[model samples]
Target: MKITVRQEKAIDFEDITLLNDIAFGQEHEGLLVERLRKKTPFVKALSRVAVFENSIVGHILFYPVKIVNELTEYESLALAPMSVIPELQNMEIGSQLVKDGLETAKNLGFKSVIVLGHKDFYPRFGFSPAVNWKIKAPFEVPDEVFMAIELLPGGLMAVSGTVLYPIEFNM
Candidate 1:
């Protein structure tokens, strides 16, 4: 089974939404993707999909967010709601999407990315606890689960503050 990863297209919208819903066993993530797509912070290049047999089997989205303190606001990307079809969960489809998405993000000029995800899975991609860099999540979550990765050298080194997600994330 071969899988191809590529930037999402308008034509893949419905498949992506359905993929997210089925993978997550809920509709909230699918709805969030739709809402975020309409917002200014949505980076088209960073939203990727994994295609297997010409069908979208996985999806990942990285949206603009801020780490702000009184002195400054550092722009970054947030990896949220990454999904893979249940039947394909352990086949590395999600990994490919993440790797491709992160590369696309860096190439597009994004410096860093944060994710609230499985402690074990993300570490393989070089993510570490955001707390190590004094970064905080908008809500309470376990330290290991809230991770961050630098796309370039020292990407998060000078940044320290709470992440501010978009309004659509809460809706």
Candidate 2:
């Protein structure tokens, strides 16, 4: 199926929330999305939806998070709660949303992005274990699943610290 990816609009909220709930088979992720939408660091340009046959089939959101090392806190994006309609898993919609979101993040001057996600899935997008950059997840997690990508050349090479995710993520 042909898919088009574009920035999410206000009209897409209900569909996006429904897409997340249906994709995850739960309400938690959808609620998280709504909460994130209301907070600072919500990058509307980086939030995207995948459309097929005039309907939203997938959605992705990127928001700001901090990587604190001693006195300095570096800004970065976090990829979380990305979802596609369960019936269409592996149909390339999720991949397209990820690729587009990453591009948007880079263009917007983000130095890096972090994701606590599938070890097998995120690598294809150039993510590697955060440990490689001396970065760690805020909470304990398998190193392989806590990943980071440098948007700027060498952006993450010198960075080392714990990520600080927004509180809404814990909801």
Which regions in candidate 2 have their CA more than 4 angstroms from the true location? none
* Model 2 lDDT, residue 1, Cα: 80
* Ten contiguous residues with the weakest lDDT in model 2: 151-160
Q: Pick the candidate with the highest lDDT.
A: 1
Model 1: worst 10 consecutive residues (lDDT sum): 41-50
Per-residue lDDT tens digits of candidate 1, residues 67-88? Answer: 9998999999999989999999
| Model 1 misplaced stretches (Cα beyond 4 Å) | none
Model 2 Cα lDDT, one tens digit per residue, 1-171: 899999999999999999899988889898999999998878899889999999999999998999998868888889988999988988888899999998889999998999999999999999999999899988889999999999989888678899998898887
Q: Each prediction's Cα lDDT score? A: 0.92, 0.91
TM-score of each: 0.98, 0.97
